[model samples]
Target chain A: MTTTSTKGQRLPQTSKRSAKAAASDKRPDEDASAGARRRQIMQEAARLFGTRGFEATTIRDIAAATGILGGSIYYHFASKEDIFVAVHGAGMEKITQAVLAAIEGVEDPWDRLEAAAVAHCNDLLGSSEVPVIVSPYYSESLKGLRETLVAQRDRYETVVADLVEALDLPPDVDRSLFRLNFLGALNWMPTWYRPSARLSPADIGRQLVQGLRPR
Target chain B: MTTTSTKGQRLPQTSKRSAKAAASDKRPDEDASAGARRRQIMQEAARLFGTRGFEATTIRDIAAATGILGGSIYYHFASKEDIFVAVHGAGMEKITQAVLAAIEGVEDPWDRLEAAAVAHCNDLLGSSEVPVIVSPYYSESLKGLRETLVAQRDRYETVVADLVEALDLPPDVDRSLFRLNFLGALNWMPTWYRPSARLSPADIGRQLVQGLRPR
Candidate 1:
């Protein structure tokens, strides 16, 4: 059987749509000003895309939301698809890094898994837009987005699988199935999780890990 | 805090789009036959809607898939939204009944809850199309779908909550969070589930309950 790997293991191929947009664009200088402007656009774009959907939110809408003229958006990004790719790519990169860092140096594999779960949940809950943008709806509209997201998602699951494999659990325990169930639980939080809800994301994460940990 | 109620607790006021479609018709006998035909259309519509999308699938597409003329679909259902409402409404009703039935004879709360989860997962797995239709995408599209689904969903959760409450676990266990984590694990199975996967749905269901049972 093929081993199920982690999110970091699988990097998605560049979408033709995104690739076309990238090829059409001229890169800005690596100066601080250019970097700041790009960051601003990505932040605003993520919010709008999460709320209104990738297809419904236009270049003009992103520009208007960011206090930049429609043409100005093109100076930083080639197209709306390009912006979407950037937002998703950057979000995954940050989340993967945080998760990897959070679990570092933890001795117990299961404890490291729990820490990763908490860190990932905190990251999702902390950012209002990431969950929405990463939701299946927006992912469906953008060609190649699902593959990219699923690949990154698989990387995260791999982290859990690796931890499970490292554990001295019962020989009968199917680590792959355990990882699938655990990840499924973690990923569905964004659907019902409201910031206004009584439970903090960290608390929820803790409970989840506690509930799923092998006896 | 307001209780997040069951999925089918309250249906929203029909949209003007659906209301107009309902109002424009006049034949009395057509109403009875229309209801039957509407059911037929919805059955077929759900399959198509589940595969594609409610918006992406046209009346003609549904008709073609159902082996009926495009105009014939109009004779039964009012519009696309009407078909959507019927498909979602009817599917939830069936699932609710199935789940309730599964738990009825079992006196043990934990067993009942396990049965309910198994029933739900099996129902979704058995009706390949219904799972997709009842997924987050379709839930997000309709104004009342999520509320309706959650209302029905709460009924299932209530069973689990009652079971969790009766358990001999420590007092510090949060029943609500327990239910949330349990339901989260079960409900999100469709996102990654492949029927051809090594574990059968029933196997996965039992393993999930085993992993999640309070220690």
Candidate 2:
């Protein structure tokens, strides 16, 4: 009964408890291996799901890609949607952590905002799965799973909202849309972004954040 | 003909001309009817294709949506992909015209930029198909279509680049990336934008453009 209800948890609180339950059900060594197996399946599944349409990628494809048996894949994930949610939740967690860590100890509101953008830009540029898995969360195929996916995504919003609040933008400025404009430009990076592009993510992030200052 | 050729053209150029040719080979009214039918099918197909997955949308489904006989759809569109290209191309042309009209005769670069953003935002908010059809241009199902889709998309980039070039940013500003940040933020509106978001699209667009000013 010590477990907290996670209906509103933005982070993956359930994963830890689920792991603990599995640990108690199995030997410690088996528990470690199962966790690793689940992770491996997710990475491969994300690749296939990202490259191949999610509907097109069958359970056997995910299993074969990760070198696991199809029947055993079910032991880790109940269904394909469950795997997608896990992969998506994990990706959101990764970037959120990166952004939060980057702004750590930054005292200036503007500087903190810039730092958060830079961290986010780098993560989007560096991670293959970050954009691929996250972009499809809005698609029709994920209509049933949107609530769960959106909650994970909203966790990142709290960080940006805090940054915007600290900016103390003028009342005339619509702060919510300001935050959205800042984020939209950042997320749109995956569309035209190429490694050959001359500007580093930090430089771009700074330019975007600079737009929020009083004209 | 001095007219530049569109690389990877998916639909017949000058549907009237093609229809006329078909008419000469068939009957007199065929030319006008062919052109009108082509437009009608593309409009309804776009509606369905925008809401439904492109691959998942069958020719029969398109015919049913448009109230055209199943076999006649082939007369207007050689294949499903051809219809897709036509709808996508038409959508791009519509928005391009809107933005161009907005920026026309505006001497001040900043004024031009804001006007352009406002027009774009209004169009995206007002049009149902703008976000839906344009998004699929980036999907894996369109791998064979990427060259054509990207070329059409790049046509819009020239407009943004010209605006950015007029701004005459400091030598330190990465103009290409600066352009991307502006466009990305603007393009991202479709993801989170809602009628109740408390800010009009024009208001948000103006705010985004104002970010271009130096601190």
- Which is the leading candidate under lDDT? 2
Clashes counted in candidate 2 amount to: 2
lDDT (Cα, 0-100) at A105 in candidate 1: 92
TM per candidate: 0.74, 0.82
Cα lDDT tens digits for candidate 2, B67-175: 8767677656667787777777767777788889999999998899999999888887765443325552255677898888777777888988988899857776677
- True-contact fraction for model 1? 0.35
Clash count for each candidate, listed in order shown: 12, 2
Error of 1 at B166 (Å): 3.6
Per-residue lDDT of model 1, residues B1-215, tens digit only: 32222334333332222322544567646544545555566777887665555655677778877777676665555567777766666666666777788878788766777777788788777654433254443333465555665675566556567767875555666777777667667777776778888777777777777666655
What CAPRI grade goes to candidate 1?
Answer: acceptable
lDDT of candidate 1 at residue A52, scale 0 to 100: 48
Q: Report residue B93 deviation for candidate 2 (angstroms).
A: 1.4
* Range of the 10 consecutive residues with the lowest summed lDDT in candidate 1 chain B: B11-20
Question: Per-residue alpha-carbon lDDT of model 2 for A1-215, expressed as tens digits?
Answer: 12222333223432433444656654778777777787788889887766565665677889889996676666777667888898888878888999999999999999999899999888877655434364522546678988998898899988899889888665666677778878888887877777777778777788777655554
Q: Residues A1-215, candidate 1, lDDT per residue (tens digit)? A: 22222334322332222333444456534334555666778888887665545655677878778887676666667667878877877777667777899889989877887888888788887764343244543334565566766675666566667877886666666778787777667776776788999888888878777766655
